[model samples]
Structures are given as C-alpha cells and as structure tokens.
Target: MRYRPVAFGLAVAALAAVSLTTPAQAKPAASSTTMANTTSAGTTATRVVTAAIPFGQNGDIPVARNYSGDSRYEIAVFRPSNGTWYIRGVGAYKFGQNGDIPVPADFTGDGRAELALFRPSNGYWYVRGVGQFTWGQAGDVPVPANYIGDSRAEAAVFRPSTGKWWIRGTAAIAWGRSGDIPVPADYLGDSHADLGVFRPATAQWWVRGAATIAWGVNGDIPVPANWVGTAKADLAIFRPSTGAWNLRGTSPVTWGTNGDRPQPGNYAGDTGTDQVVWRPSNGTWYLRYRVPITPPPPPPPNCDPSYPTVCIPPPPPDLNCGDITYRNFKVIGTDPHHFDSDHDGIGCES
Candidate 1:
C-alpha cells in the first residue's frame, strides 16, 4: 500500500480507489467444492469465492487431469481449508499438462486453481489458468536452477490474491542464476522486485505487487531462497503494507548435494497462517524446518533477598528491604502507617 499526500490550490488531496469488479456469481455456495469436515468455532466454515477470478479461460470452471509412474510432484495445501495441490507431468526438458493435478479433498475455493509450471527445458515456468489458453509469464515468472540435469525448484500457489505468499528458490552456493521477469523497460525501475498480493478484511488493493503485503492471524507468504544442504537457511515473511519483512521464524532442510534441489509444496498444518507445514522428500510432514530454535530469554531473576529494591537501568540504588526505614509524614496515627498504600504484604511505598 503506497500512500502520498498532494498539495492542491487550496486543499490537500489523497488519491484513492481504482475501480475493478467481477460480474456477480451465484453465492460462493453455488460453485463450492465438497468438503467433509469444515466447521469452525462451532460454526460451518463455508467456502466462499466472492471475487471474479480470471483463471486462464475457464474463469470459475473446474478441470481435472491424470498421471503416470516413476513420477513425483511437490504440492502445497491451502491453509485450513485442508486442500492439497501439486504439479504433475512436468518433464525435465519441457512442460506438459497431460498429468493429473489433484485438487485436495477439502479444497473449496473459487475456481480450483493451481500454479503455472517452470520447466528448465523451456527456459522457465510460466503462470497459466483454465479460461486462458496461453500462460501469462509476462509480469511474474519463477526461474529456479537445474542441478545434475534435474531441476531443483519448488513452488506453491496459495490464494495469490491474499497477498501473503512469496516464492523462494534454493541453488547450490556455487549455483548462481538470476530469476528474470519482464519489467516496464521505460519505467526506470523505481520499484523493487519484492512484490506480492494480499487480502484485507475491509480494504481495496490489498492484493499488491512489488509492495508490502500482510496476512491474517498467522498470515504469511512463502519466500524462495538458495540454502546449503548442511546448514539451515533463515527466512522472514515480508509485510508489503508496512514495507517491512520480519524474522517471524526460520526453516532448515537437509538439502541434497550440489545436484539435488529442494522440492516445494504446501504442507497441511493447523488451519491458520500461524502454523507451518513442510512436506519432506520422504513424504512425511514436519511442523518446522530442522534447526535449533533460540528460546526466549529467562525473566529477570527475582529481586535479591538482601537488597529488595534495586532500581534497574536509570539504575535504582540498591535498597535493603530489611534495613530501609520509612517515616510517615502525611499520616498521623497512634498506630504506625507505612508506605504500602495498596497494602498487599510489603510495608513500604513500593
């Protein structure tokens, strides 16, 4: 979200609102996917696709495919909805759509949409949808590395419009390749390549590109990076709305050798963005990347018994609870009244 103030003849104006709308569809319920157990907080987590998605040529239509043997895919599930998606029939040399792209059982979103494929033989993997016949590699395209003739790249496409997802590519430290995408040549490139989309509870253009994006509760975007097989790689989610990326957490994978690449997919986890689900090459699911986590610092040690009142920082002088004496000036009484105004147990103006 980029905002700037403009000074006019006698007023200050904030430019806002670009109109773009999709034709109304029957309720999102009209074209919902069958979900077995979809209830939340005692209520039903109904599927809702409120916007018009230009998914290739099909728009809101759904399609299916099949696969063969000795082949594997990297699939990522949509958070909570409990859906799974993967890339099938991708050859090391080119892209083919003949294989099955299974839509997870619980996946009930607006058109069942997966990601575009990136086949090294063809140079790169382009994004394509159902309605459209050709892939749209013009603006955003992901180009990963090729290790030992086998492509070592992974990708997961969440609700792209959510603006909380990012792509990461890991190559051998020696594997150096720049991911190139088309940019406006004449624009002078004032913007950075860090781009993403987002969806807010009540805001327009939350789905931003090359801009700050944030997510709900555990909302986060995936980032692609090159990491070593032996060491762990730290990753931070980018917040486009604030132009800040934070080290919300880290991920470490036992990477393959120079020729081995990490397979990417959406892992099933607790139905929120706060949880991370990564599927390992063995097809087992993990809650986090294998790495040491730094536990939070221990709370300041209990005040020393001999010196009860020790000022911290502005550095309170050490005062002994046993030796510190208090004299009441404001209150006069036959009975002694101390500084413990609230009177919990301590007898001084603590």
Candidate 2:
C-alpha cells in the first residue's frame, strides 16, 4: 500500500520501541457503535469510527502514524472479529521523519506483510523485511504492489519527478513516464497488480495494464477496490470537499466528509474490497460495504501463560548500528541514542 505525504514542520529525531505480552484468551466478537444518516435519496449511510489500514488475508489492517509531536512512530494491527475491531500487536519505531509514508508488503514472500517507510530526509526507502535502499530519485512515493508475476508483493514507488515506476522485488524494473499519484491494482485482470496514476490537474487516471487509457476528471484521491466482483481491481475518486465518490462503473455517491483519508480493503475476506475512510480529526474509520461480509473464524489463542501480565509486542525494527546494509525488519520505536549513527535521521543506513 502507498500514501500521500502530509506537510508538517519537524522537530529533533529519536528512536524507541515497546514490546508487550499477554496470556491466552478467547477472542471477542467484533462490534461497533454505528451512526446512521439518511441521505436525501433515502439511502441510509452507516458510519463506524475505525482507525485502521486496509485489511490483509488475516483480517488484520496495519495502521501507522506519527507518535504525538515527537519523532517516534507507532504501528499496530487492527483485527476485526464478530462485530468489533481489536487493536493488537502494537509496536513503535523511534526514527520516523516528517513526510515519511509507512508502506507494508510481503517482500520476503513470507505470507506476512512487513511495514516499511520512505524517509525523505535520506532520500532512501526502508522496508522491515528489506533494509534501506537508495531511492535517490525525486518525488519518492512508496507504492507497494506485485509488479512481478510472483505471489508476493514488492516495495515499489512512483517518482513523479521522472514519471518512472521502480519495484524492488525478485527483480527491479524501472519503466513508465512521469506520473503523479500512483493507483496500483489488477487493472489487467492478470492476477498480478498493475500500476496506474491519477493526474489531479486534469482529473484523469492513466492505467497501464489491460489497456492504457485516460479516465475520470477533477479527482483528488484514488480509491481502488474490486467493485465489479470480477476479482480485478477497479478505480474510483473522492472529492474531499464534497465528500463524493465517483466510481468508474458506478454512479457517484457521498460517503465521507472533508479531512477523511481513503483506505479501501477487503475487510471481510470476501475477495471484494470495501470502501473505507479514516478521519484524523476524531481518529475514526468509516466503512461502506457493497456486499455483506461473513466474519472470519477466530484465530487460536496466542497469549503466554508465563507472561500473563506482559503485553504481546509486535516485531522490532531492523536496525544495525554503523551498518548501512538494508535489514529486513519492521520500522518502530525512537532512536534517542542516535543508533541511526550518521545522524541523517535514518537509523540503519547500509
């Protein structure tokens, strides 16, 4: 997954990580308090405040955000069961910089996605399973997808400055022209995700998969999901000010309000992605589902009896003091000791 950078002034940097453990326990059903509003058209819109990223195979959505007003970063997994969303496996990374985007992918083909970030301060990309790599290009937006035919996803980015797409998977490919705001999906229906970009100035989407054509107008953000139930990804755009969504093969509908972030995912394992929005103002997530999703079976208890009072901690960040080599580990915690050594604000350089 990829994200647009947020503009904000920075303070001094620090790195820290927190680990927790807990005892085994039965999972609770997922439930949420929903507020429903009837539109003029008589359609009832249900809004649930859930702060999470897109859902993965395990019904877990990994969310990352800057820790308060400090340089630390926090990442956690949100699991939806029964009718409630549970936040678990929380971890923190110490060396997050302003304008950094946390991108999670299964770079090692481990069946689990690892969290990474694009640190603007060093002009490099960092992946938990794959360490730091030089992405000296300008407009380095972290765009993760399966550009290769492999089943695993890769750490990729679209460089608007050069209109090029770069993927660091089993192999590296740099192609395409200058493009803005990448919208990756299975555009070709080939099972492998393809790359697309939306030019906000012209409100057009340039897709490069089954066919290359420009579509849409006056779009601000790209919302990709399996709207047609064809198992292939489709495109949509959200007009933030108006809270209207223009789906390529569907009529326009209003779902969110201003200041809501688009986060589309297949939260129910239905193979169909659902539209989601995260409003930072209240840290709530709103989801709109086209089809009813059957909740997944609960996972087995993983609590450690010996450490009943200890909280289960998520994986640690991949950091090597003085070694610039890219190590595969999730980025979390603060670097108060300057473990990022060179003081470039990026912890493990090599």
Candidate 3:
C-alpha cells in the first residue's frame, strides 16, 4: 500500500486492529442501475453540516476531501462501526460500509473529491455514480488513480499474489513483487499517476519510468506528497520508531506518535503540502503545515548599562577571529573608555 493520492493504499493488516466491525444496513442507491454486489455509502447532500463525531472503536485509513473546491483539503474520517464519514467544512455522510476500504478521489476531475470504496470480499468497486464493477479479487490492494490523464480516476488494484496491477479499461502490468507496497502518484508531472512500489524488505522504491531509490526501513510507512507543488511526487516516509516524518532532503519532523497515521496533503491551501495524522484512538486529527520558519527577532540592542551611549546589541553577532565583532566596543588598553577594567561583557572597551 502507500500514501497520498490520486489514491494510495496502506496495509491495515500490519496493524494490530485491522478487522472492521460487523456489517450494517447500507443505504440504497438512488437509481436501480443493477449493482449486484454493490452498496451505497450514503446520500450526498448540498447542505453543509458538521456533526460531532463520537470516539472511534476501530482503526481505518486516513481520508481527505476537497468538497468546497477551495484548494484546501478538509479532514475526513470513515467510521467503520456506522459507515459514516465526518468531513470538516462539509457535512457528515454515510458513503461506505463495514469491510469497505475507503478510496476518496477526484473521480470527475472537478477539483473536488468523491467518496468511493473497494470491497475486497466481493472484488468490487463502488464509485458513487460510476456504478459497481468488478476489478480486483480478495487480498488485492486498491490503488485507484488517473492512469490515462483523462481527469477521471480509474479503478485499479495491485495483486500481491501475482505482482500484477490491473487498471480497469487501462493497461495491466506486472511491476512489483510480493511484499512490495503499491505507491501510485503523478511522479513526472504528467498529470497522470504512475505505478510505483515500495519494497519493505530492501527499503527501496521502484517507480515505473522513474528512478529507483532506497530510503527507509521496514515499519516505516510511505507518505509521499507534492511537497513543492512541482507536479512530481516527493519520496517521504513516517518513522514510527522515532515519531518523525522524513521528507527527502528536508529536515525530519517530530509531529506524529506511534499509533498515529500520517496523511499528507494541502490542508493549508499553500504550495507546500502539510503533514496530518489521524489518531484513531478517539477519532482526532492533527495537521502540521509545512511553513517557512521565521527566525526570532533580533534581541534588543541593549548597551552596557555602564556605557548607555553605545548599544552593540545583546548576545552579539558572529564572533570572528579578531574579537566579538562589536564595532562599538573599543579595546580598553588601546583606546579610551577603559570602563571595563575586567575582561567581561564586550571583550574590548566601550
């Protein structure tokens, strides 16, 4: 599995609590389009409401939605117990059912994400208006993406058993091997998602048509994103051991803990992406905006109280070979103002 989207997959199986709760009565479809093994998440409403979400009992994948088209990705969570999706700024919905893997994406290229699901039990995909279709079998990881650059996300899955990727109506290629996690993203700025996989065994990533790089170790979850908005994806990983997110070439951050799931996206509506973690313990979310650090303002230019007339700034600047680099400090032995009889504060005179 993977992170960031078009739509990425993470192995829920590795976690201790991966099983979903019992099935509930799914909402019926608006139209009888003949969906044999399909079900509706819930009805989409125009009314924007934020219902208070209760504590979650089961762990699920992190979801984000750009429902307002405001360029900022709102926080979304899929509660498996009730199949309800609580999205910030948008309303709460029931777009998925138990045992359904959440795959939120921009299916229409309308700049907003749609609620979608992939049921491994029946090997079917339920895209709200796109109809239910059979694409993957049980045990296949769902990796939906816009492989054709047609502004529409195609239903796809990576079969670990055979190391094959099957994109419905698109090409089917065998790229990764068993124990490799599928990482699909728009790597070349082509506006089309490319096939990639992260091998946990070797800590290496092999992207089709792209470069191969070894980055993280086992137990580290992939959290690649468009960090610079270069249209290409950045190779990143969240280390559970250190609670740090390592963006390739950038400084590692200590924003997440052990059980928190990292969800990187443009939550701040800025060019740089933000790091978000979904704490499944209580259904709480935390977003860390990747912003430039503003250096602390220069300290007050406090002159020596004894020599109040000359202010050379406190704590001083870089000290070179000559002295403390204070222009106002006059060498007491060589110059006037021998107020500093002892070698204190400023090395020199006044």
Identify the candidate with maximal lDDT.
3
lDDT of 1 by residue, 30-126 (tens): 2243223223444333321221112111111121111221222222321111111222222111112322132221111232333334323332333
Scored against the true structure, residue 296 in model 1 reaches a CA lDDT of 67
lDDT per residue for candidate 3 within 285-340, as digits (tens), equals 66655333335699876654444445433333533325444444433232223434
Give the TM-score (vs. native) of candidate 2.
Answer: 0.56
lDDT (0 to 1) per candidate: 0.25, 0.53, 0.68
Off by over 4 Å in 3: 1-60, 291-350
Whole-model alpha-carbon lDDT for candidate 3: 0.68
Q: Compared to the true structure, candidate 3 yields what TM-score?
A: 0.67
Selected candidate, larger TM-score, 1 vs 3 = 3
lDDT-based ranking: 3, 2, 1
Off by over 4 Å in 1: 1-114, 117-130, 135-254, 257-261, 264-292, 299-308, 311-350
Q: Model 2 over residues 1-350: C-alpha lDDT tens digits?
A: 24333223222122233322323322323345343433334544343323333222243344532222122222343322221112233443333344565565566665555555566666666654345665545457777777776876666767766777777634444444564678888877887887777776676666774455455556468777666457677777777988888778667877788877666665434444555666655445566654333456998665323223322222244323433333322233444324445545443444
**Whose lDDT is higher: candidate 1's or candidate 3's?**
3
